[model samples]
Target: MSNSGHPKDHGRRRGLMLVLSSPSGAGKTTLSKMLLDEFSDVKLSVSATTREPRPNEVNGKDYFFKTQDEFRAMIDRREFLEWAHVFDKYYGTPKADTEARLEDGQDVLFDVDWQGADALHDQMPNDVVSVFILPPSIAALEERLKNRPGSSPDMVARRMEDAKREIMHWRRYDYVIVNDSLDVAYQRLKRILLVERLKRLRQLDLEDLVRGLLGEA
Candidate 1:
């Protein structure tokens, strides 16, 4: 680890893999959008999926839609950083794009579940910072799911059941934010990102600062 308060000069500035995981109605998606909009250096990693796009969802912007066979082919080719089956649809983060972004010293944001977050950390241990969002209560979660205009009663029930399972993995993440209010949750998420961005280990250029302070060339 680099000195906590000092700067370094040897290595290039490192990138961060920020994973935001939450249950279906926990407000992670909303928080992610806020972070993306607020941070100019952060890039959203668009996942590839086998599921059909929803209304107003662009193919490459929202997700890279692929046929099941194409997705499987990528899997066989080892093109994904992490891939998983969710609700019978294949979803994956393409390895090349994420690497390229990191190499350019850009932070990548992932809005995925715990399984995906774990897989990402396994692949890139040093770069990842995982956060889990929580609803204030199960009742609030159920109400949020039910209030979504496009969801049917059965869909809401299914999400609630899945939420319980997802919430069980909360302890695995580095930070947990209980989203009681959108504005408060967004601010908390933003703060986490900003603090992590300044971590000494992530700022490899600190070596120079240390050397300079010691009067070394």
Candidate 2:
């Protein structure tokens, strides 16, 4: 079975890929956590990484940690939906795991940059719904990056420069959220997911569901 496209809806709904991208200081990470915690059916796409696991990180749950050679083999085999090199390490979404979850009717969430989002959408245009989070202003984004714990002034400056470039890709997203307030932006994000789940393309089985109610199915 193909892992990156729509599966048969059958009697149940097919899952969707929710791709959330933002600059470093935006509230996308926090909002994604909220969705996972609040929704029982939503699952985080645990990535495969070539980097060493952190002190408290688990191998499978946090990330599928692998050697560089192993990662490259998967890449060569076309096993990743999207993969990237970052900070000298490789990270990717495993096609098998993601596809299994989707076929089982569970929503999968992706916390990726615009490049990764674009790649995933290209591979699974029908299944993917991309959202770009924005700060109220660049100054606000700078302040956020600077205020982060353990963030040095130099680091914040570099991130601010990167954020400028990131914000330029806002037009590529299917939806955009201006994160003026964390709570409000989160609400908007939730609404977008709710509506997207109800989309006719995603809810392909809804026709029979409605027809059955009318005794015509």
Candidate 3:
């Protein structure tokens, strides 16, 4: 959201804030991991959380673990770009770190729910590119949820119910892809990112470069 420290290069541009959202069992997490693994320029947005860390969850890597009072103080100081209360814990994207990465020309990928995506886009409209993933059909979605490891029948049913509600928000996204095949969907997702990187508005020095070419400067 913050672009104050951007470099002055015609070829280099500001980083993207790519938001991927989907219901459970829709393959959003899989795609997010793929992007991170394949792209060096893309970094997952690490959030600050007011929750006890689970085993092997390192602070400042998995999350910026904070005490409740510290988290509340951050909220009061407007340190977060987007913050949410979920399941009695505070989670937020710290503005400074995100802005620093963007200024360094590194795209930040956000693997968030629709609500989180909406909050991000609302706060930073120009930098956000939102995508919603979908299952091929309701039956397919059900099957995926059922087959998930350690998922009980009740858990699957609850997730299925949540999926229906989540799917309703797909129209709010800039793009939607039905993840019928993981490979095909990944290709499409990659293409979207590549094309978005080439957007004219994002290229900060094009106007000057073009003028120099035409001898108009």
lDDT of 2 by residue, 152-181 (tens): 988998998898888899999999999999
Order of the predicted models by TM-score, top scorer first: 3, 2, 1
The local distance difference test score of each candidate is: 0.88, 0.89, 0.90
Please estimate how well model 3 matches the true structure, expressed as its whole-model Cα lDDT: 0.90
The TM-score measured for candidate 3 stands at: 0.92
Candidate 3: C-alpha RMSD to true structure equals 4.8
lDDT of 1 by residue, 90-180 (tens): 9899988889888888889998888899999999888899999999999999999999989998999899989999999999999999999
Q: Residue-wise lDDT of candidate 3 within 1-217, one digit each (tens)?
A: 2333333335878898999999999999999988888787789999999999999999988999999999999999999888999899999999898888888888999988888888888888888999999999999999998888999999999999999999999989999999999999998998888888888878877888999999998
Best by TM-score: 3
Give lDDT: candidate 2, residue 16. Answer: 91
Which regions of candidate 3 fall more than 4 Å away from where they truly are? 1-10
Q: TM per model?
A: 0.83, 0.88, 0.92
Best by lDDT: 3
| Each candidate's clash count | 8, 0, 0
